[model samples]
Target: MDASNPGEAPETDETLPPDDPVVAPKARSIRPLVMIWRQALKYPAQVALALVALSITAAATLAIPAYFKVLIDRGFSRGGDIEGINHAVELLFGVVVVLGIGTALRFYFVSWLGERVVADIREKVQENLLRLAPGFYEENSPKEISSRMTSDTTLIEQVVGTTVSVALRNTLMAIGGTAYLFYLVPQLTMWMVLVIPAVVIPITVFGRRLRNVSRTSQDRVADIGAMVTEVLGAMKIVQAFNQESRERARFNAAVEDSFNTARRRIMIRAAMTALVIMVVFGAIVLLLWRGAVGVASGEISGGTIAAVVLTAGLVAGSFGALTEVYGDLLRGAGAASRLAELLHEEPAIAPPARPEALPVPPRGSLSFRNVSFRYPTRLESPALRDFTLEVQPGETVAIVGPSGAGKSTIFQLVERFYDPQAGTIRLDGVPLTSADPAEIRKRIAFVPQEGVLFSANARDNLRYGNWEATDDEIWEAARAANAERFLSELPDGLDTFLGENGTQLSGGQRQRVAIARALLRKAPILLLDEATSALDAESERLVQDALERLMADRTTLVIAHRLATVRAADRIVVMDEGRIVEQGSHGVLASAGGLYARLAELQFGATEAA
Candidate 1:
């Protein structure tokens, strides 16, 4: 385990910037399903195979009822010709065996196709999500994204893999069985057709209602998932404040809303089932009475009556399955709509029509020319107003200010995390908006305020910064960040498994790991937001010394609250209310008695200010 320095104080709110405004929520749309399916059809061979299997299965299922007809008319009837009866029985058994074999192969092929399509969909969604701008994550919860990739994809999977095939096969069987019944007894078939209106009309109306409720239920479930994830991720504060009851109540309420919506859906489905059974069976019994009269009058043989009965039974059973699977289709359609909305969203940050190519190895020069930006959630005032600054190649600049002064917004603009609404930012004399954001970001490294770690080993975490780094290079970067000593001390050293979000590691240790990541990148530009704030005075000194060495030939932008860190900067820029209020050497700014002087005095006291 890495040693903890409890003696080190946590950074003040003044050091860490306020959370940015919430991203503007968007209404869900239904275009993505079409696009997803269109892309999925690129694998025509798989889809065609699934369709072939489905067709064969449906044909075989319908063929089963014909075997029952043969058994009833040939094997059960004593008046039939004995030699002809035996031959018919033999043929019936042979047909059933052939169909049973086809059923097994069809099931296997369709199921395999479902799995493949789901895997393909998830891979495409994840890759597109990764390509999205940082602004995408700022507005959406990780849970919301995960739900689309997981739960929504599962819905599509069921639809493609099972429900769709079942619906189609059952539909074919229903149609084919109905046709066969007409051939067996044309008079009884008319009654079945007459009852169709009674069943079809109610189901069509109620099924529409069920589909809407399904959509509401899915959206509510997603809300519950997202809320739980956000709160559970911050469980430390949730536990500290004794807010478990509150969170439980909140989650229960969301879940209850989903339950209620789903209940409404279930009620509609139940009603539809009752209507279908009542209509179809009621017609069957009425038609059987007519058949009984015909038999009494000797209009049809006992064997013919039995054959018609068997076909009628097949028709009713297949129709019932079709009705139920139709409800699943409605629900699946609702899920498809939700997933489609995410896939269709227009990314807030779009690349230029003809993006300018960035230099292979970017120079360290960075500049902001009258840049101004307002977050999508807040349009009242810009986060950074007419921000103008320039850093020479290989110069280190520290940005310091009071709360809400737009200190971190500068780094956001520099990294093109958000493009300015007005004016421009440039790297190596090329406008950031014109250059590819991906290309520009490749030249920069960021150490965020909170050290975000994936669930992985220490070595794996360090390697994220530079995937091609050799083991020696990774260890060297760890040493430069002052993290190698603690990493080496762990029981498993570099191979030691870290818990989710690196929860197993101390805050300072996580911060050191983040530093090691930045060092590994070895980009021409480094951006740090309270990189050493998690460490004790002693550890801070050690890590700070290492950071200074790492920053030697890179263009560095640091957001600092402590006067000590500002003093090490080659130049200091003071900002207030989204505007640059002061820019000079720390000593010069302190002597100027401007915003920087007051801020330094507020933190260091009047004696230190002197």
Candidate 2:
């Protein structure tokens, strides 16, 4: 592939960074663009108006040459009258006016259709992404997916809004101008039409290369986007380690790689455009020479020859423009196909056609029986093996374990974020698989280790758990979590905007806000996964106090690495590898002298011994 710029050299694959994922040949047929077109058809009124406007624009364009012919032969000929010439000029001006109006209408309708279609695609893609299982995300990066939603959708917008409109209008002019040329002089038109194959065959070949390069360019662009998202997400870490210079160098390399690929695609398209234009105008030149010969022999009039030239020029320009439009459509088709792939991805877990409803009065009981599972990305090692546990209604059961001991996996399974490879999980005696995921989630509240909060006001964040909660309910929940004081102290009290991920608040404040969110949820079951592990002692004590209040009259599951936090639970379950090694009160487990005893020694440090 040549570079997009005439003087630049083509970039080689060897220049790509080692970490870049090799782009594979995954684009399907043109069916994806067809799918997008189907969406455009949904707005029949806009499509119809656009088509009508397009016809007017094309017809007006084709009519100009006829009026020019009349102006030349009947108005400007030696024997022509001034009155006739003036009438012809008036007709020409009228055509220009009609053409101007037609062009504007076409632009308006075509642009509207493009925006509407792209908007629909973006909305639907986002809706689907939210429901896709975590396993899908594990296999794909979030940044790449986001790039598709933005960059790829923008490409589709260009096609629907501009490329398709230009192609359709040009097609009509090309065919119409050619027919008009025949009416003026068949002999010249015949020779011009014969030149079509020479240009088209070359376009067909180079266009394939351009399509391949375009897809690669898109992938490289997505790579750059993914890299930027990752780096920005961990900006604090990068700055803390003073890795800014290294990160900048890496990012520059990715950007350059993307530029090289894009340049190659551009060059291929440019070459095709130039080739088509040369062939088209060369045919016109040949026809002009023939027409001049006819006029020299007195067989053709000057006005007639002029009309033929005008129509031939239109035909040539239209054909040349088609080559460029072809390139855009191909690129857009590739983008549409990528988006289609995402849209068609079915979630790994889907609710049954008629999902069974949990018992009306919510019970917090949770039970896992003989469950075995491994993460999709980590298939070699089971995260949980033959794990069985039961937390009766209103009981607080704490799971204590080292990293990778299946502690958090218990919370994930309960949330139905994943399904175990074997055995069953049930809530309120109903098999989890039998109930809808949304319904099951409504009865449970989850607080992850890293408290999740969006960029919103304090009120909005608290209301996220219960969108319909009144202001008083929100205040009550905040007080319960000990977040009321800080929240009220914010610039706008409950209305203060939290930065991304609640960056405006301290670690403890975020935790308290998270607890308040869970508290507001008012669910019968609560999932706490290391919620207070990162907080300072004061914050931890406050958060723990909130947790205890939250646990009352609710079935709670806590995943804690610090055994001290779980010491007061009704029961403590110790897990190692993927199975439970011990289960009993902290005292019983300490006396049993197993994994729990050693962990207690490391954390609490043999309280009696001390």
Candidate 3:
């Protein structure tokens, strides 16, 4: 459990359940908030400055009642001495000035720490997320993760910037004011102390309910975020299918669910606040009643009675503020626990310590020996079974198979996205697992069926394949890939902003740009997943020309469904049900009266007749 204040308990175990995808297992205590404290400690200077300011302001606030006591006893009681009254008033004003200055400084430093800490946390979480394997994403929603990065971090910011500061300042005031109350009238102070348990019991009981509801509330909000992202990203599909009403209904339910959860959370907090306030102030009213009796009997002086009332009120208000602070801390703990999960997630696919370096002067030879694999999400059916093949340097092998025949799986394995369950895959004779995944990828260039482009200008997107490529070298590759014509016609040439996923370019133009990117890579191995499958006849001809130039001196693996596209390849491999059933040239396969022959007959017959 987290100590009520920053420096209370030793650090507790931070381990959480490994498989909490929605919300972290409900935090039973604010121990998760200790993570935020550790992060804040990185800047000790700022923390020290903020603490100094907080202490000064707290002391100044408590000094106000003491000054009031003096103003009453020394100034007003002495036949209204104007000079003494003015002097006491000036001292009170000075304290007020000190309080104001300290508060401003405190705000500046704590807010700076909050923003800085959240920024560092975001960078750290994203850095770890980038290192995780794709399988992790398969198990977690990107939308929910995005919510964690934003919504959850905002809550952490509140804790660091506002809630924690409030907590510390109020605790100080409560302790100081209570001590002064004892000095004024110990009997009254004793009675108030007895009521402390009344206030504490409710906070402890209501706090548990609030913490559980807070976690559920955060999960509900994440669900709404995921829903909005999903619906907006698929708006076209929704309208085309005329399902807007259904989507709206679904979104409404999600929003309502979120609101309902939040309502439950606030209700619990409201009840806690009301109960604490009533108990605390009720105790203060009773103490003041007793103090009035003492004042009447001439036992307690007027100034003393006045100071006791003021100090007791300050103490009561501080205790009351604590209920809200405790709730905010619980909420912050929930947020911190979620982010900690992301920050501490170990990448399932990390580079091995002391990884073996690939051989120099890459030969581009790829060999998959009896590789059998299944996707993490679909383990019951293997995507590749005993998939054995070898492509020598400078060889172009086209892979043809029906959907789910493992053509794409071969590319995935080559990229080392997932390791095979059985058998070895090697690039140049080095087992892929032995070398670093980055080194393996640096030697291979891949162009998917749809050209994947970032939301960047043409120069950046083209240079993505080789960041060090010169402009002249980029143009040369662009010309070879037949992209120079349209690229030169682009409004700002290569500097033009290619909208999200290169939506600014036509299908054929994007494919050419992708080919130019691959050409710029100049890697020894190329993987093309039917680059021309989605283009029209003219576009296909242009992309085919570009692909031919790209394949000139590289060992290429092409996954093609259009039989006409792979006719001139050095060899063709036909797969079915995760196994290669046939391997031969297009001519040989056509004459063999096999699966490829039938597919070729259907596509070729249609093309020739057209």
Candidate 1 at 402: error in angstroms?
A: 0.8
lDDT of 1: 0.76
Error of 2 at 421 (Å): 0.8
Candidate 2 error regions (>4 Å) = 1-29, 608-610
Candidate 1 per-residue lDDT, tens place, 1-610, comes to: 0001111111221211233111112212222245345645877876787677667766666666565666566665668567766776677677677667766766776677667777876776677666667776765656766765677778778877788778777777778878877887887788788888887887777776776676666666667767778898889999999999999998898788778877888888898998898888889888788888888998876666776676677678877777787787766666665544454455566789899987657788998989888986577977988889999989999998998899898888888878899988889989988988878888999999878898999889998989999989989988888888889998898899988989889999999999899899989999999898888787789889988987898999999977778697999988889999989897888889888889878888877875
Report every candidate's CA lDDT.
0.76, 0.83, 0.86
Model 1 compared with the native: what TM-score?
A: 0.91
Best-fitting candidate, scored by lDDT: 3
Count of backbone clashes, every candidate in sequence? 0, 0, 0
Predicted candidate 3 versus true structure: per-residue lDDT over 1-610, tens digit per residue:
2111211111232434544332344556687787788888999999999999999999999999888888888765747777877898999999999999999999999999999999999999999889877777876778888888999999999999999999999999999999999898988889889988888998889998888778767877777777788788788898999999998898899788779988999999999999999988998999999999998998988888889888888888899889999999999887787788788777766678888888899999999999999997799998999889999999999999899999999998898878899999999999988889889999999988988889999999999999999999999988877788888988999999999889899877888788789888989999999987667787688768777866878999999988889888999999999999999998788888889877887877734412
Candidate 1 residue pairs in backbone clash: none
lDDT of 3 at 4: 16
